[model samples]
Target chain A: MAYELQYYPGATSVAENRRKHMSGKVEKLRDISDEDLTLVLGHRAPGSDYPSTHPPLAEMGEPECSMRELVEPTPGAKAGDRIRYVQFADSMYNAPATPYFRSYNAAICFRGVDPGTLSGRQVVEARERDMEEVAKFQIETEMTCPALAGLRGATVHGHSLRLPEDGVMFDMLDRCRKEGDVIIMHKDQVGRPIDKKVNLGKPMSEEEAAKRTTIYRVDNVSFRDDPEVIEWVHRVFDQRTKYGFKPE
Target chain B: MVNSSDTNSSDTSFLQLEVSPSRLLKPETAQALLNEIVELEGIIRLFVHGPGLPQTVPYGPAKGEPVHHPANTLIEVGGQTMELAVYVGGIRLEVADADVKEQVREVCERVLPVPFEFREGHFIPTRQTVTDYAKRGPGADPVMIGMTDPKGKLKDHPVCILKSESKGND
Candidate 1:
């Protein structure tokens, strides 16, 4: 705790943006109401009570444990809310946040959260209310560009694929549509039609995306350009490979 | 857009015009590109390829729902209206020779909105492969040799523009 923790090391904007994400310092880009976010999440109906997996922690007396006494349960856990998840698929073309960075941000910023990262998508699981909060923050922040990043619970196939001519990320489900300059979400994460369309504001231009993105693309800021990050990565890789095996 | 009267025996060289940024082309742009290139000289056959846009959602929770993609629309190419099923990433043309390839490149530079690579190699196979022989059998037309997918039905792959000498293989 004494020494300052460095989230990432590089001289480029991409690296700086990555550090900003990990440090939970992302700029809030849009204002999405809680109701709109809840509808997009599709876990429960808006204004409905969060379903519970167990009774409230206070009602059901806990067993005497030193760890339980020292560690405080999150509000969602204390209220016995059911576990729920929010998943995202980001495009490879200068999207603000990629799968790994999404996971890193979630791990650093949120509590009682389980973040899963894949090649194309990132999923964060928490108690229903807790996940709603996390999803809302992610949706309303600069971390997500409506055109390049999408909320997709399943069939998240567009990350590595090409963007359409209009520059919107390809979604097989067609969950979001580009109307004029803004991107609108007509369907929930699982591809079910929602009652009201959610306006996700205007998508970032190529110049803006290149400046804000955390991804190190060859066209934008290539990974090879940052020698400090490369050296650190190679050091880790070398150590892991050399010492990975035990004495024969 | 196929001319039924044209036989494709003499079509030897292949050229592919790959759109840069590797994105799917909208119907309007695809139609424009097709209309421009199909009128050029020495082009025997033309084929468009990219990831498919299925009519119905192919997988996941909304599998049966209509895709309603903007790209999946009827496009008129070479005065013939046909359903465009895939995002036209690259337009492969079977030209008469190398000179025709250069002509095609010039036309592409003029018509294409985005940057493209005018590749001069065999982008698509001209001769029938063993898989095609096994799946399509010997009775298959020589022209349809490598143009049509062996597994996919002909109805599925509807974008075939065949220009003959009498009309416009310009």
Candidate 2:
């Protein structure tokens, strides 16, 4: 008999969103060009070659190990691409992905990934090309809300602050802003002004955001409303506590 | 600190109106509200507070560059010019009596499109602090003790006194 896999426990919409993101089942809503993605990332130029940290694996060679023979090297690894990162600052006001969920999505869905979650922001680091692919998935899927999340490498305040009068997330760097109804990135993640304005589609309406958000808030779908999730949390805690007390 | 006996005998209370859809208030909305409230009797002072807008991109790769925000501009209020730095988070009204407070509430309800939570409390310091002396010098007016800007030069007055014909009517 084969065992089936489960992502998360809950009956609410938020929990469902969590399951979808973790399983990589989310629908891609927009297609930002490779050039535009690279522009906002600001790691390297749009058409520039990825800088290498070391000689390619084909040239440097490898040690004789069974594990190394079985596992295939990723394209970035084969090319000896330098490790780079993309970070997101998600708003506390029902942003599509919170810090923990972002890390979970990255860890479960991608290969050669290193994800770190902080209080207000989440970071995913990988070899340059791999990182760009992951960043595109995050930006295009239901994982990101253009108005509620920002691509920020530094000075990432305003996650907990109220949204500005324009209904866009507060960004001190002003890396992205609304042009009419469309949200455009006129600056890179680090606040360096860019020559071209990358158009990120129109922001989600408040109603749509609430429906798609993975966060459980009392104002939206409360966590307490999901009995299965609560029970699972308690069960996990109880097992950890009991196991810590004595090992059989 | 201003001596408790320094201020006039009028009972002063702060009426704080916290607006919803809290971010992104238009300057026109603020202007309309101010024009209405400033004409009401028994109102001693008006102050607007919210997130501060820095003149430059204070940090990161674009440090020292000008920050262009639509909300950060000069607004015309009651025929007086007022510079708005932050998105108007809330408006604080210092009223002399219950009658004036009621009038202010009515004005807010009529002017503001979004719902607001009305609170009565001491939102600002009534007395002077050591920082005031350091910033405003020794000859600072007692009435303006707590009103001076902390970042402004010693010679700069925090609050501008607008001379309008409506001032005498109030």
Candidate 3:
């Protein structure tokens, strides 16, 4: 069967996390809106006392970030930002079928991002940092096997991406897709982390697409596969990708 | 090749000329070689000489047992280090601490010719172990010691090794 690969960096990042509220892990929530997501910037854990992977609900020794935040990268997130984490899911390593947060098994929630200017400019800077990391991971994965070989040159059909593989890694990548999940993805910005403000309350569903004032502009979300590679991939992707999205 | 008898001196010495690389090595080169030998000897004595590395599994059946071993690179031939030698066994290299020794032991058992009986005492140590035991209280197991002349025999120099100590403990 032909593989239907979806490479949505933002959504895929929170594969194991979209259900934070369902698990009863977050507490003392303030301004938990789409805008908050952009302000938060990077991955964060929830509880300070929870574990290394989670952000502290209150000020604790460990980084207080959410599991979802950790799954994505917020390279520009500063120390003073209030963060909370519950669990962390990392699919970059090990098998793809098992979608858990990460090794810490904790999640994070955050408020009061960096206290610095939480503007679109700040968010873009933060998002760029995260994307570079994911791009680097894509490179490393390509080196390990060929399935991800031509990622930088592949075509993006909506959110879908087609990368060249050496059978083994492609088999794994094929198994990457899950059931009942609508994955929107793009490898062009695969590892690149983005600060997005996709309003959950927005009329994104067909039921609300008509007469819906809430416009959902799908911003690209990047993964911080490696801290160092996040920026490197941005430069490389610009040179590698065939798309004509030049600097406006 | 000249025999040991050629070393004979005085009292009607017979001159049987035999070619040796010594002719080309020269005294300065020889001195440099000698200096290298001394430096290597110092390294071995300090690290590889004794039990090479003292492995004591506290509360294990052979708790105080010392294991002597040499790196495969330093072949023990007639109690001398040999540059060239075929090793029959593997060197189960590993990092060990309180928590990870069991894992290290499993690796060692597979590589070393010794059997894998932790409490039953199944480990053939190197000559280095003999000296290590002499330093620690008294007689350690014999297998811990290595061969005498490993070049032709098992030189069994000590197992020269050390590890970075962890946090807290001095």
The best candidate by lDDT is: 1
DockQ for every model comes to 0.52, 0.44, 0.01
CAPRI band for model 3: incorrect
Expressed as tens digits, the lDDT of each residue in B1-170 for candidate 2 is 54444542233343433333355467778778878887777676667776676667777666787767667789886576878877776776567667777888888889877767777776656655667655655565555544445666645434756543433222
DockQ leaderboard ranking: 1, 2, 3
Give fnat, all candidates.
Answer: 0.61, 0.49, 0.00
Which is superior by DockQ, 1 or 2? Answer: 1
- Identify the candidate with maximal TM-score: 1
What does chain B score (TM) in every candidate? 0.80, 0.79, 0.20
lDDT of 1 by residue, B123-146 (tens): 666566667666656565655665
How high is the lDDT of residue A209 in model 1? 92
Worst 10 residues of 1 chain A by lDDT: A154-163
What lDDT score belongs to each candidate, Candidate 1 first? 0.81, 0.80, 0.24
Query: What proportion of true contacts does candidate 1 retain?
Result: 0.61
C-alpha RMSD (angstroms) for model 3? 24.6
For candidate 3, write residues A48-151 as lDDT tens digits: 22123333333445455687456643432322232321111111212111112111111222222221221110111112223323222212221111111122
Model 1: CA > 4 A from native: B1-22, B158-170
Residues B76-103 of candidate 3 have per-residue lDDT tens digits of 3223443322112112211113233344
Prediction 1 TM-score vs. true: 0.91
**Interface root-mean-square deviation for each candidate?**
1.9, 2.3, 25.5
